[model samples]
Target: MAKNLDVIEQTTNELTLAERQQKKPKRKKKKLKAVWMYTLLSIFLVVSIFPFYWMFIGATNDSSKMFTNPPTLLPGDQFMTNLTNLNESIGIFRVLFNSLFVSGLYVVIALAVCASAAYVLAKYNFKGKKFIFTAFLLSMMIPYQATLIPLFQMMSDFNLLNTYFAVIAPQLCFPFAIFLLRQNFLAFPTELMESARLDGASETRIFISIVIPSMRPALAAASIFLFMTQWNNFMWPLVVLNTNDMYTFPVALSSLMGLSYIDYGQVMMGVTLATVPIIAFFLTLQKQFISGMLGSALK
Candidate 1:
């Protein structure tokens, strides 16, 4: 009986030791996996950041040095020179103002129009509502390239060429904005709207006083999207605005590329300057942007 007991005790100790040995490999494997994931993420981050770094470097280097075989990785001391050259080449402030005005106007008008339309689609029951919503979704799938020629022709017929209004007016009908606003509206609590209505508020009042206030984050998100789209707009503006004085920032940047004597440093400086406002805007509204994204996922 004693011998049998000793053997059982020894067997149990060996099994425990084996189990610990098995767990050790799993723990090491988990650590290795974590390390590999981090390594991949770091590589991806570096790849994404490298272009901005190169752009900054280019802004500091003269044209001759820009394409040097051993590219300058360090920030050079020529940033001021580049800035001066850029200002001399073009009135940076004027171009900047034009971009801001166009983008800002588009953001406000597009968001307002889209939000109203979205609210109607999401809340109101009407004949052919499903069809209309389906159409809006279908429009999103259609590439903008397909409509460019027709749109350009219409603009030509309207004689809106070279006008900011031309750019702003056409984009006010964006289907994507409508869809985004609709989704946001659908996610909104109907109880709030019902309460407002019960308080003898008019439909418009309910929308303006109750709905709009609650939709601040969604509006912010939409505004950012519209602003980015308009600010980065190149093709339509290029087609519509023929003159340098009315050129948007992107158009002006393109013009810089065409000079018989191209200046890489000055071009980079303009790019940097042009990007600053967008970055600043994003930084300021980042909280709202995040909230808007979260709001979308609420329902």
Candidate 2:
């Protein structure tokens, strides 16, 4: 009888502990998950932003201190000196203008062409459509370097070397941009398009009034991508532009590097300067860019 009583008490205690465990709220677990997510995001953010911060800091220091044993994390006292030296050495304003002009024009014209091509390919039934799209997809697989020599030769034939047109023309028909816009265009409702067609709207009118307005997010996203591509482009500009005055920002920054005795501070300053416009551009369109890309995923 005493042994039975002890067994009964032990079972009751076990049951009570189980019940208490089951009654506990899950908020602590949820908080833990949130903490982990925030921690990861904070780490990633720091990793992404640190390089740019280091570049800015390096810009402020002279060459000797810039590459010290521990490496300088703090801004030094040479910001103005570097800026003045850079300005006097290279025509920074002219280089900046060249980059801005080339990038902006490329975005505008590239978007227009890519959007129109994507719209037609997505909506209109035409001969060789599959073949054409397949060709574009295949073209995307061709590395840019593979076509460099041919493109240079063609540009030389047209006597367009060193011109902004040479840079902008070749990139106008970007396969990836067309593919992206086409995907977004494919998501539009057929019923709406049919209704618009029944209303006797011209194709151009339908595209401008119906399609373009509906795809602002995609357009904004593509614009940012295209702008950044042209902005940070180094190789093509380096190869094509021989004149210092005509050189884009990336090419000009590279020019600051000497075979012997590279000026670390001046180069960093150029990089910092080159980076500002891109940062400003991204910030300006970040909302639209994110929303547009996310909307495509939702579709």
Best by TM-score: 2
Per-model tally of clashing residue pairs: 0, 0
Model 1 TM-score is 0.86
lDDT tens digits, residue span 1-299, model 1: 99999999999999988987989989899999999999999999999988888889989877678877787788888989988888777778888999999998888888888899999999999999999989988988888799888988998899988899888887897788888788788877899889988889999999999888888888887888888999999988988898888989998888888847789998988888888889988988899999878766665
Each prediction's TM-score against the native? Answer: 0.86, 0.89
Angstrom error at residue 129, model 2: 0.4
**What is the C-alpha lDDT profile of model 2 across 32-137, one tens digit per residue?**
8999999999999999999988898989999788768798789999999999888877889999999999999999999999999999999989999999999998
Name the regions of candidate 2 deviating beyond 4 angstroms: 1-25
Model 1 has a clash total of 0
